[model samples]
Every structure is written in structure tokens, then in C-alpha cells.
Target: MSDITVTTEDGKTSVCSPYDTTFVSKAKTIGGRWNGPAKAWQFDARDENRVRDLLREVYGTDGSPTDDSDLVTVRVRLADHEVSYRDGADAKFAGRRIATRPGRDSDVRLAANVVLIAGKLPSTGGSMRYPQINAGDDVIVEVRDIPRATLSLEREGSYEIVGETRGEVDVDALLTEREQLLARLAEIDALLPEPEGTETTTQEAAKALGVSVRTVQRWAATGKVEARKNDQGRWIITITI
Candidate 1:
């Protein structure tokens, strides 16, 4: 909900958000510094990749978007201790479910359908106080306590009954299940504009998205890609494929 803007001057870049404590803190990690006059955080444009990731992590937007459909939001129960969302600097700072037997849930996901914890209080009664989750690949969801609900996926993936009063949930199972839950996040285009003619510092947007650079640029231009840029100049854009 912030009017955070990322702009470039010469080869350096700066991020200006709506005086947010969380944003300013995250921005500082990527070498963002306070600019009294500009009233923004300044850093090198070459570090755009890191900046973009931080924005996505904290606000779900990398100061760019392909389009509206690319952004999504969903809801889920915090069901257990094994699950964690990436809405914070680390798992320790993530938001969490207050209950497990009949846990709380949020629909926070990246375009790739990766599950993420919302940066702020995503629901009523939900608190920002997160009990740290040990980071690992082990994803175990207590399906037995879950209510019956159908989950959707990104890229027209499929529907699955992620919640149920059934049996054991393993890491491998939750890995796939994570997609269903995260796929429901409140997706949307970035409110900020991309700097004109500046080349993107990373190909992650295209590569992780499994799209060509041209396609990525087109998505960026039309707001279809998770992040995109205009091609009004000779500069070429790339993402890590």
C-alpha cells in the first residue's frame, strides 16, 4: 500500500517509500541510506536485483509488474510450526499462525507459487509477533487439523484439497502443497514506474519465470510479467533463466 518509487540518476538508484519503518530497515540491508533532501533510501542502480528482491520480500512488488493478473492473494491457516512465510528479513521476523489444531492462514505467494508469509498482519486477530521457525526444506503441514478447502496454483496449475482431517503431512508433500497455498496471495502490479532506458541488473525475473527476455520486457511493459521494463531505448533486459 506504499507509494514506493525506484528511480535512477546516472548509474545509481534510490528507493523512496511512504516513510515505512519496515521498508527503510530492509532497504538499509542492501546498502540503502537515508537521503534527507530526497527523503528516500539511496543505493547503486547496479544493485537493482537485490533491491527488487527485498521489495518483493517485504511488499510483494519489485517496483514493477507485468500486469494485474500476475499478482494474486489467497488465505490459509498457519496450521503448524514447520511452515514459514518470507514476508520478513528472515524466518524469525515472519508473521505466523496463532493456532495449530485449527490454525490461521493467509494467501501469500509469489507468482511462481512459492509460499510466503505476509509482511504485515494479514487477517483480523493475526499478530506480527512470529515465533521463529528453523529454516530448512522440511515442510510438514498438519492436515488432520485442517478444514477442508481447495487450493489453486499459478500458471493455471490445479486445485488440491490442502486442508483436511486426514493424516501425516511431509516435507515433499508440503513442497508441492506450498504452491497451492502461496498461489492464492494478493497479487498486483507495482505502483512505481521503472526508470527509462536503464537495463535491468538481473535476469531473475525472466529466468525464474521461464520466459524469454523479450517476453519479459513485453510483460514488464504491459504489466504482465511479475516485473517488467520499457524498451524505448537500445538497452537489453534479462532475467535469470
Candidate 2:
């Protein structure tokens, strides 16, 4: 490794490894020269225990430390590619399964779960070494940019390895399922009887129309639609549908 020195306008100096200093200076001085901020240092290791120790040092806890109970689970499917790492496990790139930590900056630490391929790799192994990925012999585990929300784990101050698995649902398939559900709900709504009176309170109209109470109120207020007042003095709106 080479060495380099950087000096500030005030003549403050800092020394770093050639690679490290070049990267840092490019980030600090060149601004957009490298596209975005400098890449974070990844803690890569084959030993699970060692990986956990490194995480504790960096994240300030052995497990997720946060007051919020909302957790996130991510399943990243890498393009068939390989990458080289300090350990043999990262030689042949393969897919990885990861559960998110509770606090912010969780996405930056996914390198802790990198896994390499063995002598006899999967059928998809050939694609893992593509130049676009440059993953080497391991499968590249691509992180999904969109984060997910998950139910809180029962254990406190610790995260459980939920096990990784192959075969994932496609985004299009999920959207199709949602559309079908909405259609079915619309059919069910059509089967219900209409509200008794022409004018009904937003709440009553929502129940009778099988829609959200807010939806009914919005129509009444914005559409300049009229509603009926009940004996209890509650304003009820009749849904056009």
C-alpha cells in the first residue's frame, strides 16, 4: 500500500495509505468527481462470530439498538457474478439473505453477510463472474434500494438469523395480486344493499358503501354534496355509488 499526505488551507495535515488517501482526497476535494461520497469500509469475514464482533464495535452494540420496535427484513438477489474478498468465502459470489438492523445507516453494513461459493458452485455460478458485476467467483448480493418494514422480534437487544432461502416473488406478480384483491373487494361491495336514506352521515355512508369513512367525508366536503342529519345530530352523506 502507498502513503499520501493531505493538507488543509490552515496547513493541517493528515496521513493515510496511498489508496485510502487518494480515495478520501478525491471525495473531499473533487466533489462530484467520483459521483457520490466515498464508499464505506466493509467488514468482511467468513467467521460469523468475528463478523458479529466487528459489527458491535462499529454499531456500538452486539445487536440492534433502537427505541422503535419496527424492524426490517431484506432479501437481496444478486446477479450471477463473483467478487474477491479477504476470505475464500467471497471468491465465488452467491446470493445472500439479510435482516435489517433497527437504527439508521443499516444499509451501509450489508457487507457483513457476504458469502462465497464452494468448489462446485450453483448452475448460475457461471454468470456470477460478469465484468459488469466483477464479483469474481462469488455471486453478487445486490441490495434492494427500497427498504422494507417487518414485525418486531420477540427477543430484546438481539436479532435472530431468520435463514436465507431461494425463490422470491416478482414485483409484477405482487402487483397483480393486489389488483385482484381490489377487484374482489369491489364485487363484494356491489353485493351489499344500498344505504336506507338518500342522505346519510359520512360514517354510515362509508359502512354502507364499503369504503373508508374518510372517503365519504372527502366527497361531501369537496364535491359539495349534501348529507342527512340523524336524530342524534350526526351528519350522514349518501355515496353516489
Q: Where is the poorest 10-residue window by lDDT in model 1?
A: 146-155
User: For every model shown, what is its TM-score relative to the native structure?
Assistant: 0.30, 0.22
Q: What is the C-alpha RMSD of each candidate to the true structure, in Å?
A: 19.7, 20.0
Across 194-240, the per-residue lDDT of candidate 1 in tens digits comes to 44543363354466567776776676666553343356543245432
Question: What digit string (tens of lDDT, one per residue) describes model 2 on residues 1-241?
Answer: 0012111122222222212222344334322122124323222112223433333332222222121122233333332322332211222111222221122222212344343222222322222222122222333343321112121212232222334333344556447646755865796789999756466667677888788977777766676556755788666675554
Superposed model 1: Cα runs more than 4 Å off: 67-241
TM-score, model 2 to reference: 0.22
Model 2: residue 175 alpha-carbon error in angstroms: 2.5
Best by lDDT: 1
83: Cα error in model 1, Å: 20
